[model samples]
Target: MMAGTPSRNELHEQNRLSWNEATKAHNSHKGDQAKFFREGGSTLFPEEIELLGDITGLSLVHLQCNAGQDTLSLARLGAIVTGVDISDEAIAFAQKLSQESGISANFDRADIFDWFEETATAGKQFDIAFSSYGAVCWISDLNLWAKGISNILKTGGRFVVVDFHPVAMIFDTDWSHKFSYYSRNRKCTQ
Candidate 1:
């Protein structure tokens, strides 16, 4: 099993470390959102979306949302969506582009761990909570992640996660082993 997740302090530090020049990249991607969404734009894939059935009238919270693409996409689907991410610059760009596209959403900046811990709520919560494609490997605590989702989710709320495990191999067996281990090691895990 993997190690226990780092403390909130450590995660915050790492979030900062990971965001260097990331703003520039997110900003550039905003230019191509139209083309991007035509492809994927972090939204639900056609198959997984079908599994969601109808989200036409639910309140949803999207965590670690990059550039707010998926969050806005959900809003387009009629879910009241909020986008949260650790990158301040990314959140800002998300807001700007969202406004540009006439999509309305609340965007906030905070580490997911810290945000969940700090945002106290009463009996109310979102109808659904989601994170896709770009979550998971960014953190180390699946238990805590589940707990946080549970906290912000209403009774029987649905939580969806879509992402690839960095360590997952299509075929790691000896059969048809064509690539060198060194090549896989040199590939970008993120």
Candidate 2:
């Protein structure tokens, strides 16, 4: 490591701040999420629905669940759901959404790695561990993330990640090829 280089935790803190800002911007574009959920709307895609068939009665933990639309959707399907995120703003909004929608879900504001450790130390385990689109790009260490998933899951518990293909990152928003497929730059910008 080089001197004055940000450590992993420092990088995570930076990302957390970015996400706090991003969450507010992201939610602003989605109108009346609480009302949508209350009227039985879901943010889940059809593929995820099929992959997670019959989640009823399952204990599920949603990692990096920003604003928790999907987590609340899972709860509507009868799963006991807990949503965890690094951004305080996201968790706050998720809690408010859950309350307004009358959905039963637990929202925790903590880094996913720390939350996993705490949940494991408390002997808590879940039947399903889930994360979706736009979640993995913020994860600096997939190995640690995998270990955390393992720690928080019961035997035979399923871990599901639905995300964009790695090749998708090679293209810019303008649909032009811009980045190397193997780019590992610590910082990504829009």
Candidate 3:
């Protein structure tokens, strides 16, 4: 390591491992997730999705679509959605949910970077690319990731992101430094 240099992957393996573990945890709790969401549905719906303007026949892509929650959410709004993640277990669970919920969509598991390359080579482009909360920082380079988004999005297509503010990222609620989890804290707020 060079003087004053840090030890971190340009693309962190820690992020990937964490996601893998999260997929496990999510599957362990999968039986309850849909029920939990139904009890307190959000204001977000197809109308909010339509506010982005016409997507009458547009294709949508959601990257890092954990367990396909919001991905199915989008499919319900009429956009044809294909969700990609690196967790096969999560993807399988999502597919099962898709079948049961009657949301027509597809899910696949692949590393995010390779996903970009393969999609491009397949001559695919999306009308909308959506990602929410925490997925961006896990990526190796924001600029490169943005470029991939550009490659994936057609002319006039849009990419949207919603995430917790940086300041909120610090300070673990469980008092654990360097590993803040949100489950218990979000529950307290609710």
Candidate number with greatest lDDT: 2
Q: Specify the poorest-scoring 10-residue window by lDDT in model 2.
A: 181-190
Which runs in model 2 stand beyond 4 Å of their true positions?
188-190
| Residue 102, model 1: Cα distance from true site in angstroms | 0.5
Question: How well is each residue in 50-162 modelled by candidate 2, as lDDT tens digits?
Answer: 88889999999999998889999989989999999999999999999999999999999998878888999999999999999988877877888899999999999999889
TM-score of 2: 0.95
What global local distance difference test value does model 3 have?
0.70
Query: What are the per-residue Cα lDDT tens digits for candidate 1 across 1-190?
Result: 2388455566566665566357766566446675564453545678657756688888888888867877888887788888888877778777876877677788888777667776544444788888887577565456787888888888888888777765443345765655454332332211
Query: Poorest 10 consecutive residues of model 3 by lDDT?
Result: 181-190
lDDT of 3 by residue, 109-147 (tens): 877777888999899999998887767645555677788
The ten-residue window of minimal lDDT in model 1 covers 181-190
The segments of candidate 3 whose C-alpha lies over 4 angstroms from its true place after superposition are 1-14, 30-54, 174-190
